[model samples]
Target: MKLGLVIDLDTCVGCHACAVACKQWNTSGTTGPLTDYDPYGENPAGVWFNRIRSYEVDDYPNNKTVNTPMSCMHCDDAACVTVCPTGASYKREEDGIVLVDQSKCMGCNLCAWACPYGARELDEDSGVMKKCTLCVDRIYDEALPVEERQPACVMTCPTSARFFGDFDDPNSEVSTLVRERSGYAMMPEVGYNPVNKYLPPRQRPKAPTIEKKEAATGQTLIGKWMKRQKDAFNDFGKGAR
Candidate 1:
């Protein structure tokens, strides 16, 4: 099965919930304890499997914000896997989830450099590459409830903006959304053929405008009051001068 995610850009509110959930679950998971460097210090940095980036379209009143929660794309033509000198990085044929074998990883940073999506990060403490595994360990656990087997990001999205499923199945929810919503892959020009797709924000309907009536025959109370106030201010300014 081609397992992956379909993220709805329309509903995502730029909340870091998915990223936080991914970090929390993966920290103690099969591939982690994602390391932090000087976490409480001046230059705090850490390895994270998922991250959120927001972009603004247009300007001012008409501007719209797009929040993109990104992770390893699990590409069909994964450069990270190919560039690994020690074969530490590999994509599983069974599910198409890209993972790094920490045991064989030599911290060469080649995979990180090779990835166009910037999905992989080196564990500063462990000296190994780490990335999103699509929560492989969690998804395949027979002991867990089937509903809870999805990736942590998909589980914790409060807006239900994230979806996890078999992308290869044409009838799957992810595939259906892709077909109906014109979901698209990021950086297609890079040619990684990323598995995960993003559903673009739906077009907002324009608000109905009210046609302005012609000027009233006489100045209204508020308008007349404003005129009197302006004259008073002008007279006061002249007296002061």
Candidate 2:
């Protein structure tokens, strides 16, 4: 079904809400208790599934900030899966979600090195590799409400920038948004054919400029107020003298 995410870059505000949510939910999920080393210390580090990166586009006056939240792309030609010697990393045939079996992992670090997107991380505590699982445990659970069966990141995004659905379905929201917004895959030249898509920032509408003829004269409210302030200051200065 090619289940994946379609992120809207235009609406994302670099809040890191998705990253926080992913960490919170997945810590106690199927891949529970993600490792954290020196969280309160100077060199705080942890195994995080989602990461938010912001880049400044263009230069100076015309510059814009682009916030990109990245995780496992679940590529069609997933190199992470191919590189795993013990078959620890594998992609699901039914949904195209990439997952790491911690039990089978041998702390080889091959999959982490092979991943071009830096989506995989080694859990030193468990001596195994960890990555985004698309919240498979939550999505397929019958106990949860139907509408609440999305990934933690998708559910917690405050701006509604994240969407999750089957990319293979033409009628799905992900597919429709991809078609309408001209969404694109990251680093397509790498040939991984990532399922996750990102919608580019839309061009902002320019503010209408006031022509010279439409400029406010001295009789305008603001001009008159300024004139009154000047006169008051001059009178105060004369009285002080």
Candidate 3:
């Protein structure tokens, strides 16, 4: 089953909630206690499974903001898995989730370099690579509610922009969204064939416009005020003469 995410670019508000939620859950997850260096210092940096970026579409009045949250694409031709020197990073055949076996990992930065999406991060505390596992542990756990058994990012997205499902199943939600919304893979030209898809922003509805005055008989408050000012100026001119 090719399981993955369908992210809607139109609805994503770029709140970074998905990133924070992913960090929170994964910190204590199977491969974590994800490290932070100088967290409180001037140069704070840490390992994160997700990152959000905002970009402006145009200039000034016509500008539109696009918020993109990126993580492991879990590509069908995963470069990270192929470049793993110790065979630590691998993609699961069952669900297509890319993961690193921390035990086998040698803290080599090769996988990170191979990935074009910059999905992988080196956990300094564990001295191994870390990335999104699609919350594999949570998804398979029978204890959690069926509805809640999604990735932390999907669950916490306020805009409901992130959707997780089996991409192999044509009837699945992700597949349906992809087909209906014209979802697309990032950097398909690179040939990684990323499993995750991104739905482009929907066309915005045009703003309602006020109708032009037909005869200009009705005077507005502002127009009346302007007329009064004009009348006063005329009277002042007459008195001056």
Candidate 4:
């Protein structure tokens, strides 16, 4: 069975809770320190297991707000694994989580460059490239005693926006969710065959227009001046910034 993540962009709310939770768990758990440089200072950069990025799409009157939480796609044809020269990065055939054996890592950044999505990050402290392991520690921990073990992001998400499961199973919740919600993969053109999927945003009602009403009003001196100013900026580039 191929395991993966299903992210709901519509319900994400631009919250970085998942990223924070992943960092916390990975740093304190089985994984090593998620180093930070000048964290509270001017330039801050660190190795993060996950990142939440915002984007504006569908311009004009029908604009849309999107908050995309991204991590390792754990692609079926993972480029990171294929490019690793030290046998550090490997794709688990059982679960499809691309992981790095820190012990074997030689601080080479080749895998990070090969990844199209920029999932893997280089840790300055350890001198190794790191990426999300899909919470392997929690999933296999006997102490937790969970009915179904899942990633920290999936487990800690307050809105239940993140889902973790085997995508290959036709009966699985992840599969059913993908089919029902019309979920889609990001940047299908890149063709890494990402395992993670994002549900399309809910369509909004068209905005009402009052152009005709405004046009009916007799042009005042101020309106003429405004028109001349707009023309100056648009046509003549006089007041353009």
Candidate 5:
């Protein structure tokens, strides 16, 4: 019954909708004090359960942008749990979620240092290490309808790119999707054994075009020079804009 996420990189639009939805739901409900500091001032810092980062994987002539949604990995051998001296941080065997018992925490900040993925953070108010609980409060509440019980971020994702399910079940949607689409774990070298898996970027077929030949042959010297200048200007504008 180990619960987890299955995020699809293929359909993600690089929009921050998922992150914003997490913040919005976690603030006024069962989630902790997701505070924002100096919001209007010079620097703005806040606790975020989910973060979306856009990565440019420019494979030269065939470039692509991948938008990754990152959060607590809820690992099988979670380092934060091992580092907690007071048994505050523990992984739930039933659902495979890692949580910190705020009442027992001493705000030692040791747990945060142990996490290589930057998953842990010190909660100033609770004096404890805080991270994504995968919206545990909503998931377990019997008051809500069974199907409706899911993480706020997953529920609000416009593209339906986020999936919630039991990874242990071989036939589950998440697991089936993983197998069919070639899913991969993030930072496998770290050996955290994360429950969630990222579906690999689908390989698109190269269309037969005259441009490929033009690039390979380096023909039309003047045209090539013009295209280069135009490319440079476009790149500069993209950076600036």
Candidate 6:
């Protein structure tokens, strides 16, 4: 099954909740105790499986802010796996999840450089690479409730902006969302065929403009006050000129 995520960019609020949840769950999970260096220092840094970045689209007045949460894409043609000299980086044939074998990793940094999405990070503490495992340990556990079997990020998203499902199934929620919302994969030109899809923000309806009426012969107090303020502003501009 081609399992992956469908992230609704329109709904993401840049809260970084998903990132925090991923870090919290994975820290003690299959890849426990992710490294953190100088966390409280001026240059705080750490390894994280997910990251949220916000960008403003268009110019000031008409601009929109887009919040993007990124992680391993689990691509069909995963360059990271192909570039790993040691057979440490591999994709699961059953679920399409890309995982790095910490034992086989030699801290070569080759896979990191080869990955276009910057999803892999070197754990200086372990001297190996790590990435998003799609919470494999949690998802496959029969002990956990089926509803709670999704990735930590997907489970903790406050806005419900994230979705996890099998993308190969035509009727799957992920696939249906992609078809209906015109969801797209990032950097498709890179030819990795990333399984993760992003749903673009929906178009907003424009507000109806109020038609201006002719000023009445007798003005109300508020209108007169507004007129006075407008005249003062015009006078100030004239004086400045």
Q: Using Cα atoms with residue i matched to residue i, what is each candidate's TM-score against the true structure?
A: 0.84, 0.85, 0.84, 0.85, 0.85, 0.85
Cα lDDT computed for each candidate against the true fold: 0.90, 0.90, 0.89, 0.84, 0.82, 0.90
Off by over 4 Å in 5: 207-241
What's the TM for model 3? 0.84
Error of 3 at 221 (Å): 28
In candidate 1 the C-alpha lDDT for residue 58 amounts to: 61
Give the per-residue lDDT digits (tens) of candidate 1, residues 126-208. Answer: 98999998999899999999899999999999999999999989999999999999999999999999999999999987556
For model 4, the superposed segments whose C-alpha errors exceed 4 Å read: 207-241
Write the residue-wise lDDT of candidate 2 on 29-82 in tens digits.
998677798888998898999999997776433557899999999999999999
Decide which is better by lDDT, 2 or 3.
2
Clashes of 4: 0
Off by over 4 Å in 3: 206-241
Query: What clash pairs does model 4 have?
Result: none
Deviation (Å) of 207 in candidate 5: 5.6
RMSD values, in order shown: 9.6, 10.7, 11.1, 4.4, 4.0, 7.4
TM-score: which is higher, 1 or 3?
Answer: 1
Q: List the residue pairs that clash in candidate 2.
A: none
The local lDDT score (0 to 100) that residue 53 gets in candidate 1 is 95
Error in Å for residue 226 of model 6: 19
Task: Report the lDDT of model 2 for residue 160.
Answer: 99
User: Which scores higher on TM-score, 3 or 4?
Assistant: 4
